[model samples]
Target: MATKFALLLLALSPLVFANTASADTTNVLFLAGGRSHASGEHEFNAGCRLLAKALNEQSGLDIQATVINGWPEDQSVFKDVDAVVIYSDGTKVIQHGWERADQLAKSGVGLMFMHYAVHPSAEQGERYFRPWIGGAMETGWSVNPHWVADLKALPDHPISNGVTDLVRAYDEFYYNMRFQEDRDQVLDLVTAVPTRERLKRVINLWNQHGVNGIGKRQTLMWGIQREDGGRGVGFTGGHYHRNWAIDDYRKLVLNAIVWVAGADVPQDGVPSETVTEDALNENLDTYPKENPRIPLPNVEEFMQLPPATNVSMEDYENAKAAQKNRARKAKAKQLAK
Candidate 1:
């Protein structure tokens, strides 16, 4: 399998492209977060731009990925894109630009969720996602821990086209998702068995409302073909943006995007250019230079989280520091008075 990723760029095409005689073009709208745990953790904006550049540069592919840095100021961007790929902090899948989900679903648009995006709260499961992505990460019912996932073998599917064995990655892989009743509509594309070392991290792994997946198989990627003729996919590995460099990892995702967009996926998956170190750092989020890395927050303390997820390390530290600064200033003013 080749190790190149497709980049998507904004094109002046109409609401939809006529793939019949025009190009085999599929316009994919990418959504990345404006903030994250660290400068390069989610790297939503940077990663989306990287994908856009790769797809735009594909030799024979005509797919374009227009990336929205954050939630669009105007929702008109969802006019008629083939697919919507979101890679950000997604605790609420129904929010964001999801207000247009009805329209998109009515038009048979494809939806792709990556990394943290796959983990929506339990309440969101039956409300919106079960019919869309087929499954979602439920709090207390799921686990997120760093593990060296060996994507050695892939299932026979368009999403796994041209993907070879022996793809290894160290990422925060969240597993044990809650799928719909007739789970046959969806299938896992990528599967990995946890190593002994990583298995220890998940002292309590839950799946299907049971304590499962510590010493067994896990689904890292899944695709859903909704009865409405639309498509939905969920990828559990995106915590580390750098993992996108792995050829098989990148190829698998590229193939899925095309497949979801209702485009013909090549036998060798969507070909992408070799991403360089310089390219990885291109459009990263801004972070405090003085504080290189922030400490990881203690989840036990926030047993009752405002959301179903933990705070990004960087954002948590920033908020903590801001509170301290405010208190210090207040004390100083009192002394002067």
Candidate 2:
């Protein structure tokens, strides 16, 4: 696959000869909080810019990352973009911006949100943003000192292939989030166990701000999924200034871009079930663009989900009974053959 990709890039190189060349472009919009007014807060603007650059180079995707300094969220910001990553954690995304963000998330455009950006409404100086990326910020699990992140149950996931474990350089571990209702939607949960120093730090924060801030003290470093009828991912880590350039983090972010772009599917992926033409036509007036590919929130969790069956229960049962009779008849006829 790598060789084929290289050969394909070489094959396409001639297009670059023209200044007006239009490449096979995938546009990515990244929003990052420039800096925080809080004294201890880290400035993540430069880091976000670096992330966009790294993703662009590695994935061959065109990226536009801007530090949304007092920028109002507008629909046009995401218009025609293939995906959007919200990395701003300090400010609460205004109501209008959040509504629009939700619209985009549901419309099949890919979304990626990170760390403090998840906690938009925390009473602290940090503002919590809305839960558009399919997860919510609740509290911390453990305040482990920046420790190693262990990834389990994701051996074959594309984004997790080369990433077995990673240690955060220097950043507060964020844990305890109110995840969305569907657990099946979670692609992978990378846990950052608290170290002795992390526990001590959590204690200090609790003593200073009371017990509300720290609990079991775990934070989400990264995650993936395509759920609620849309494709998206949420990675809450990348707090330390230097972790952004680390090889694993770099690949993780790059893989995330490709996955969210709806270009990369998990191995041996199944196509969505087809809806009947007549029923679809009837509903087209209400949901004009709705297609079989779109998923819905009430769909069963992937693990617990039975195979997709759109036909009525009676019709399904009758079909199964007929199938059994047909099998029996075929077996009886096989003796004659």
Candidate 3:
């Protein structure tokens, strides 16, 4: 009787584990790089949290963020996980690291990627990353003179359905990846106008290195593919926390994850409205004072305009007048009382 009862318990264990693995929403595993500066910690983590929340609320998908400071040793971590979103660019010190993750990912799990996650490595370049991400950086991307984002043409792709034609974004945009074989591997491409310096560089490089169209560039904000008998997607512009709240951005990212997860299409379709990156920086108070080596934009630059140092009465008078008005209003109320 004791042996029979023990056998019955063992039989049920596998059933219980199988049931647990079959989740309502595809399980999303997130791996992020650590913050170099104090505020960056909050910024990077919050962005992942926002992505998970929106995927749950708007797309009805289950998402969990696990910040892998370095590569985790446990291989079974991906056993129940349906998809993995790698936010970490493999910059920090990790034990097993990108190579380990790469091997596991090839075993048929879905992948979603962004920003530094696609940044070039000695082990991999645009070619290697392209298969994993559906796109790779060729090098026109930059954070300087941070330009505005404008969504251009898309291929009538399901992933891009209802996505807006224009939404402003601020980031260090990627440049230089031309499709290796065919454009059929691409789903959508979002671009922004290049700075004059960028334009000239591309032209000169085209003539010099036999690299055609080096500068007449647009950043690839979105890239996707059906490769390795699996689905994969990537976004090149998720380097900031404030991007989470923008309506278009919120929908774009949520949709990307859902598509990667092989889930039902969203009912309301993609969101239409969006906020300017500058507005987000000003209102959210997310950026820092001293420029840290953080890769994304600084929110504080928008919050406080430069102090009136060595300025004339034109500037001082406006501030002074505003202060005087506040004082007058307070005085009037006091006297009335």
Q: lDDT scores for all predictions?
A: 0.70, 0.48, 0.52
**lDDT value for candidate 1?**
0.70
Candidate 2 residues 306-336, lDDT tens each? 3223123354456667778999999999988
Residue-wise C-alpha lDDT for candidate 1, range 180-208, written one tens digit per residue: 88877778777787644543233223333
Better of 2 and 3 by lDDT: 3
Q: After superposition, which runs of candidate 1 have C-alpha atoms over 4 Å from their true positions?
A: 1-24, 92-94, 199-211, 290-337
lDDT of 3 at 295: 39
TM-score of each: 0.76, 0.57, 0.62
Model 3 / residue 233 / CA error / Å: 2.3
Candidate 3 deviant stretches above 4 angstroms: 1-24, 37-42, 62-69, 89-95, 138-145, 153-155, 195-219, 270-337
RMSD of 1: 11.3
Backbone clashes in candidate 2 total 22
Tens digits of per-residue lDDT for model 3 on 100-156?
556645765667766656555433544355666566544343221223445453445
2 against 3, candidate with superior TM-score: 3
The superposed Cα distance between candidate 1 and the true structure at residue 236, in angstroms, equals: 0.7
